[model samples]
Target: MAITDIPEYAHLTDADIEALGQELDAIRRDVENDRGERDATYIRNSIRFQRGLELSGRALLFGSGNRKIWALGAGVLGVSKIVENMELGHNIMHGQWDWMNDPEVHSTGWEWDNTGPSAHWKHTHNYIHHKYTNVLGMDDDVGYGLIRVTRDQRWKPFYLGNIAYNTLLMLFFQYGVAVQHLELGRVAAGRHPNPDAFKQDLRDVGMKIGRQVGKDYVVYPALVGAVTRSRKTWLRAITATLAANTIRNIWTNAVIFCGHFPDGAEKFTRQDLEDESQAHWYLRQMLGSANFDSGKTLAFMSGNLSYQIEHHLFPDLPSNRYAEIAVRVRALCDKYDLPYTTGPFLLQYAKAWRTIAKLSLPNKYLKGTVDDAPETASELRFKTDPDQRLTATVDPATGRRTGLRTAIGKLRRRRSPVPAIAGQRQAKDVRAA
Candidate 1:
């Protein structure tokens, strides 16, 4: 789409720009001075985090009472992890951990880690993801074997299976990432010889399913009954686990999905990145990344404001600084002629799903289909279908459609003065329709 064709939403005027600058300055001050430290918001967020930790601890200590109860606790815990992954893990990864520096600024196990804020997610996310947001060859965010995250894969004939597999895995996310990462480790170590590197995923996912069955069938019930006959503690543990796991998985999946699978994000091949500069890569991270609302309780409970766009741009910046930089980012985008895309989180999430839907459909372009196939009658039929064709029939004199009843009526019923045709012109109305 052309730049001129972009629908005019709203543009920042010089005055608007100046006001935003002042706002950013004030926010920066509040951040540096920690003026909001004791504010109700801070206290509230602290309480939520503490409660999550406490509940998760309870779940870990005791097993759930029955099979059904255990599943419930596990689901809830997954959701909590989702929230924490976005709010807490993302925030700390973004270095938002400095909001309260009582915790040391160590890189190893800081609050910034995605999976407990360790260095692995940091390296994989910062160095790899940001550096190569959508470039298939380098960015793990895309071709992570079983976890294909974008529609660009559909064009390949072989990618049909990958798309189907990814769909199911997205619903069961925790296992997906864990298994994918494990497979990635094996492939990186030169342990797998399959050219497409799919055997590793099969190996990891199979092992995980086996382990889950082992735990559910043998380990959990046995351990719970053996430890105590009291079912109440088990019930509490069951609920707690479900709560934690549910939050974690949902939050992580949502954040990751929103980052690249929606509007304003690009899917590039190795060729697209070959000529791109470092600044170009940085812009992709800024424009391609998105943000979502953590909601009142959710933000406090989860730590999602970290390493978002600004963090991607400047990894050293603490996570809490994200909200503060938003206004400044708007100004920067205007000044630099960049597109800064922001919206409510869930809305963008729907956009991601829509993107997937569009890509997953049979339409070639939407499916990210790379067409190398020889054209056939069926292909031509879809392409030339009248419903999809573009047609324009217009009046010869005025370049307007005259065949419509309304057009003819307008021509005859108009009270306005009409211009006369030349001497050679016919008296009849000329219809190009």
Candidate 2:
């Protein structure tokens, strides 16, 4: 077989795998031992959030500065807050700041700005989702928003138009920006609650939404357009608003879309939530999560999501630990006959684009009704292939469906395993026989 077309990766020499294993071992050690001072960049990230919040405070002051300048500053503050959300808020919420030992770590100031404590992200992402990895219906990581991430997603209005209506609601995107934490918190809890935390979350969300609308429509324009009648002044105000909003969109969406909506990922519901294996759950975190080859600095800056496998394996471990653990996670996958998924960051980014490109007026799959019944090659081809050759007929010699290779090949290229939509993370949770 041609080198490029090797049926199994084992075609490569054992030495290659061994070398990889050694490297991964080293990585795992480094990640586990990340008890040193906060890296310099992490400090900068903390400052970024603080600066945004500080500026927001100033804008709320309606201070003595030029109105245009204040508006511009407010605009910058808005984008900064969103940036803080992606870079800092998320990290704090994940308990990245646990080492700090300060209660404020979870507060908005530490930039761990959680909108709702009950959102399952705390439970789902940090606890169950990471623990379960990609189990169907059980882990929330595979679904983008409420809609399914896999091709077989049940299309329904709330689920399907999730992005559409959400986009419309967020046209200003600020609505999402303000309260993403609430939804995540809800998802993390996995069920409705009757607690003070949930009640507080409801109140906070209303206030934040009101604040977002005020910032975008009232506070922004009056402070920006009304005071700056000069053409150049008003134009700058508009430019600042657009720039800030654009930055906010790219910043928030990139990390999130990458985390859940990649090609090989799963979308589980209540049914798929059966008992899970530890190893299987870990593998899901590795496979379900994509690691873009963000440069070393950017990876750390991004809180290591570009190296998501490591993060899932060691959520309590700081992001700086990911670079060290990445190799070990890969090696672990190998030792257990699992796939270590990684790629050039941009290539993985295409998966996000494909997700958006495929976005439409929401379908049935979003409503959570995908039948787990075994699917036939014909059905697979109908969903994916235009050419019938994939399902033309089975080859008796191989005892495999005629189109098995083509269908599987498509999934494998996406670096996913058979039972394509299932979580690959279970490897970590399963006990050895």
User: For model 2, how does the per-residue alpha-carbon lDDT over 1-433 read when each residue is reduced to its tens digit?
Assistant: 0011111222222343344345544655665565656653564556666676646634532431356664656566555656455556666677666656666554234423323232433554566666655555445444425543444544554554545643553344444544544555554677646566766766876765566555644565566445645544444544555556555565556655665555544333343234423333343354456566777656744656777767776666666656766766765554433445566766566675556435443433233223211110112222343542422243569644333234445544454455544444455345432
The models' CA-based lDDT, in order, is: 0.49, 0.50
Residue-wise C-alpha lDDT for candidate 1, range 1-433, written one tens digit per residue: 1011011111223343344345444655665565444433553465386458546644553556555655565665454455445544554554544444545432334542122213445655666776777666577776455433454453444444545655555555656555544445556788766746465445545665666545433465445545876757544554444455545655666666765665655455565465554444455465456655555454443353422565555554444455656667766555433456556777877877665544444444542232211110111212323442112134568654312123212323332334334322444534422
The weakest ten consecutive residues by lDDT in model 2 span 1-10
What are the C-alpha RMSDs, in order, of all predicted structures?
12.6, 12.2
TM-score of each: 0.57, 0.59
The list of candidate 1 runs beyond 4 A from truth reads 1-48, 51-53, 56-80, 90-105, 110-119, 147-154, 161-164, 182-247, 269-278, 293-302, 305-307, 361-433
